[model samples]
Target: MGQFTPESLAASGQAFELTTAGGCGVFVAEVHGERLWIHGAGAVGSKNLTQDGLALFEAMALAGGCRFIRFETDRPGLVRLSKKAGFKTRAFVMEKEIKKC
Candidate 1:
């Protein structure tokens, strides 16, 4: 992921795994107040990207004491699926890369 690496996640103890219909995959969790942030790897063949698998990740977040779960993504398919899964768009994140000057 552009925002996180395996090394960073492993070092921070924020990495978690889920068992999907296809296989298994990983997710990263960050808790803020009662809210939890998590997302599954979207890369194909990475496994656990299915809906049931992702739901397991959400369940983990809630079980970990988070009342809300949030994740950032730019994928249209994922966005649609999330909406079907009852996730509402709370905010939009915009970014501009600042090149070396």
Candidate 2:
């Protein structure tokens, strides 16, 4: 959700609308070679995000010929949820904020 916008997603990724048992939302994914880079997903404020919804996106990626998918998130809840949905941690991400001190 941070630094991602409609313009940005439209610029370089494939956008998908989703309707699930929970509710409706959308996601943006881009094919980075054999991997589908899931840029962002939004089903906020409705209790509408579910595993089925995530799987729906995954299905789309597979049908589009992606061998795998990847994304980044800082929320613990999201990480737990993704793990439950069979997503594994392939690597650790580290970052630091630079200041012109």
Candidate 3:
């Protein structure tokens, strides 16, 4: 697992941490117009990671004062968890690396 520094999020003023009885999660979010965009998240590997992540999403949404929340993930587990948390997949993202000339 990677290190979780809540200080980093607090200093940026664009992120927050959410802790529940199950576990804890760190998320970076920003309010864009009418939406709360969750840039990324990280948490310890545990059976309750999904639940913790969902809780974090809700907290971020409420704090951002946005009705819509958006985030992207490539991890299959997270995809499933997000769906279970009532988030629908809107689009798929693809990327390619450019070779230096």
Question: What ranges in model 3 sit over 4 Å off?
Answer: 1-13
- Per-candidate TM vs. native? 0.73, 0.78, 0.71
RMSD (CA, Å), candidate 1 to true, equals: 3.4
Q: Number of the top candidate by TM-score?
A: 2
- On residues 11-74, what C-alpha lDDT tens digit does candidate 2 reach at each position? 7787877776667777788888888887767764343465766677688778989888788788
Measure candidate 2: CA RMSD: 2.9
Index of the highest-lDDT prediction:
2
Alpha carbon lDDT at 73, candidate 3: 86
The predicted structure with the larger lDDT, 1 or 2, is: 2
Candidate 2 residue pairs that clash: none
For model 1, what is the C-alpha lDDT against the true structure?
A: 0.70
Question: What value of lDDT does candidate 2 attain over all alpha carbons?
Answer: 0.76
The digit string of per-residue lDDT tens for model 3 on 8-100 reads 555544776666666677778777787777765776657586767676667767876878888778889888877888889899899998799
Better of 2 and 3 by lDDT: 2
Model 3, residue 86: displacement in angstroms? 1.2
Mark the 10 consecutive residues where model 1 has the least summed lDDT.
Answer: 39-48
Give all candidates' CA lDDT scores. 0.70, 0.76, 0.73
Q: How many clashing pairs in candidate 3?
A: 0
